[model samples]
Target: MDAITTPQNRFVREKDVEALPPPVATGGPVAWMRENLFSGPINTIATLLALYVVVTVVPPLYTYFIGNAVWTGTDGNACRDEVVGYRVGACWAFVWDKINFFVYGSYPADLRWRPNLFFLVFGVGIVWLLWLDAPKRGLAAIYFFLFVPVASYALLYGFPAIGLRTVGTGLWGGILVTIVVSAVGIVISLPLGVALALGRRSKLPIVRLVCVIFIEFIRGVPLITILFMANTMLPLFMSEGVTVDRLVRPLVGVALFASAYMAEVIRGGLQAIPKGQYEGAQSLGLSYPKMMYFIVLPQALRIVIPGIVNTFIGLFKDTTLVSIVGIFDLIRTVESARVDPVWSAPSVNYSGYAFAAIFYFLCCWGMSWYSMSVERRLAASEKR
Candidate 1:
């Protein structure tokens, strides 16, 4: 009793207790590896396999790229030696030499700046459109609809007073052709797609049947065959002496192909919208167009943005197939560069291909990121 009273007489200081050890550092690298890579036998095996791959593949790649490996400007002796076990890494020098040809194709040397300027303007316009929220979308629409196409056409195929000589589409090459083809296809297909989607869902049987047949017929064939038909058979559809530009042929093919797929994607969106939305609009005496424009489409489009973007990406990549018809897209441009006598090396081919791959990866990745951002923004807006 006496000892208990004495203990009660003293007060403990604030610093008497030590602070708890910091979280046991459970989220650090060591803990992360333990949890993710070495958590169990299966994880351990996976980690080891990944480690094996990194070790086996990465060092050689690093050395091949960064080391003192010669890839181009080899003599006949060296070329023969390479074929007989003197292996070399990628020859980027070839790309350096032939980059202009790849980028501009046969664009007149003096007029190359015209395409470059258009490319810059278009890129800026796209970035501007994408970056701003609640932008003057109507103005942006006008710029897209009225200004950009006319400006691009004028810049690439110059009119007088621009101080730039005219360059025809025939001379377009590299990623430029790919970008143009894809952009035009996207712009044209969207409205056509919406129309086709509406038509397919129309109460009118004739309209629906026609839409169905067009969609199914286009979707049934491979894109390559469609492109071949465009390249070969499209001319016959025109009047005598009415020759279409080669660039126009691929554009037509891409538009038709993309519209079919986009129609299906839009139809999926339309289907996902509740029937009550339609009934509600009808009850309000809203016409079909008004209902779609105001109520049904907005919701449906929000839901299907991902599908639409995925289709866009697919169409973008498919534009490369135009190369088969002799249009010099990015791939074809690189191939053309590879055949250059000055840059003729096996390593150069790989380098050019790698460059094209990087370009494509950047574009596709940007588009995917934009799509995801839009999806998130729409979702948050809905929640609000």
Candidate 2:
């Protein structure tokens, strides 16, 4: 034993490793429910309450809108008990009959194709702006900013070049009026507001003072008063025998009112830019206007896009107020439709309002989606 030399192995490894079993509960619906809805006593109670609310509220809505909705009827009477087996069925027929009014208002029936065509082109342009990228977007923006309004005017009023009959402004109402007012307000307000914001931020005392006064004055006054003043008071100041169109007044008022609020929003963005950004631009030998146009404004606008869109959405909904000044916009058109004695079923009225809400929701939501997409794209570019 003493003479024996031993060689010993020093390394050892496990040959019988145990495989992992699945988790007690993976991240499936069950785990999500547990985490989100029933992780604690408070959460469990909230989830139960919410489920109860849904169970109680949803079925009646479904029954009313879908189960008993009258899809095919010529009049309210047709939507009543004799027709849909119950008078309570929603009178979708009334909405159907007045759909044209909702779209074109009192635009002459024969010449509606013009507005319809204009709508088609405008819609396509909007879709292009939303779905496609700029620089390669074939300038859909140019179409909207330059060609659309002029073309809309010509087509809507009657293009002598095209042999279309002129439709008087007096006859314009319904969604046509709503769209025009909102579009004009949005288009004019943005640039005007940007200018005002810049002026308010200008180093020149006189310019900044003027901007502050105008912005404050506009912001202080009620929009309806502005509309009234634009409609009545402005004419008194005009040269004798000069005429201002009634339709033009509300449009001006809405644009001016919107611009004040928009200026504040843009100003907030401008103020958010760090002082270093301004100094950096100045160090590069950029002039004041050049610094703004090439450097500052873009970043400021990017920062305040949500505010800008919020302002636009407000202006869009505010277009309904034009009804006070006698412009029959979308809501006004619906109001006019409701007065028809033949379609005055209670169900019809509720349906009409719901329809209007749906239209506004679709518009605002689409705009929001577009804004978010643009934000994501810009963020990606900046990261790159």
Candidate 3:
């Protein structure tokens, strides 16, 4: 007797789809500036202060580089006049005059090609390694472990295989010294750092204690003190009249200093690994060394690649400190150039420092960029 009619369903179609709110035009460049620069009292103050700084500093820098008058002359009096009375900017001519000695150092006028070739080979090898994603890793290991070092040593040491003449270490200076010290320090520190890190975490108390002591003692002291000790005490440690090569002393000091820092960096990576990794290796019946090499260390080392590169960059910069100990590194070469009778003005000294600064900046910046790229690659691989 009572039949109820059912309501028809409402079927939504494409035209019924709601549109997204109009793209927020509030957060683009102008909106960002409004939020960050003019949002509140504190933000306004900071923005104004930054603008004031730009107004005060940027123009003078621009004029110094582009508009300031520069006098270029070899005569000391003329150079002096360029800076005697008023505010003067950098004298780039000083750099132009002494650029040769800065690059080649006191290496004999005829034999600059040896160091230049060393740079070329090292640079090419590094670029090759960085650019090749699918390179034969085993071949790279062989090149890094066996071929590059031996070849570089022979070539730089003038072993007559490459038709290069023997150049004494004393002849090494400027960027050559910086490169040699950093390269040798990097080569030595990697293995030494791994050993030290392992020893610090060893089951043997004695070994752990020794490594701890070595790392702490080195880290506790300033690198300048270490360089001084290396320069003075090393000669005494050797037999009298043995005459340790001055270059060798600084190289040893740099390597030792770098290794200490590297050990701490590696230890951090090791600590970040879970204990399960170690226990898993043991459960698989792997020996201590085999377990570490096969499972633990590769992951740990990858974790620490950025840190390793940072330590390398630090050591590279610290090579400049050898100048204080009378080793003629790049900085010292620049200092020596400033003292040249032809370019002894204050402006010239400033220009020389600028040149050295640019050189250091280029190297350190490149290393930092490489470290960043490696970090990103590792992070992406982990995600996959």
- Model 2, 1-384: lDDT tens digits are 533543353445659778998767858999899888999999999999999999999989887777888777777776666655664656677888889988888888888888888888777766776565555565877877888888888888777777877778888988788888988899899999999999999889999999999999999998888888888787788899998777888988999999999999999999999999999999999999899999999999999999999999998988888888888888988888988888867788888887898899999998888788888988999998
On lDDT, the candidate that comes out on top is 2
Please write out the lDDT profile of model 3 over residues 25-73, one tens digit for every residue. 7868988988779999998999999999999999987665445534465
lDDT of 3: 0.81
Off by over 4 Å in 3: 1-21, 25-56, 69-88, 132-134, 160-163, 239-241
Give one clash count per candidate, in the order shown.
0, 0, 0
lDDT of 1 by residue, 73-140 (tens): 54322333356365666565666666787777788887777778888878767876677564676677
Provide the lDDT at 279 for model 1: 96
- Local lDDT at 328 for model 3: 81
Candidate 1: residue 278 lDDT (0-100) = 89
* lDDT (C-alpha, whole model) for all candidates: 0.83, 0.86, 0.81
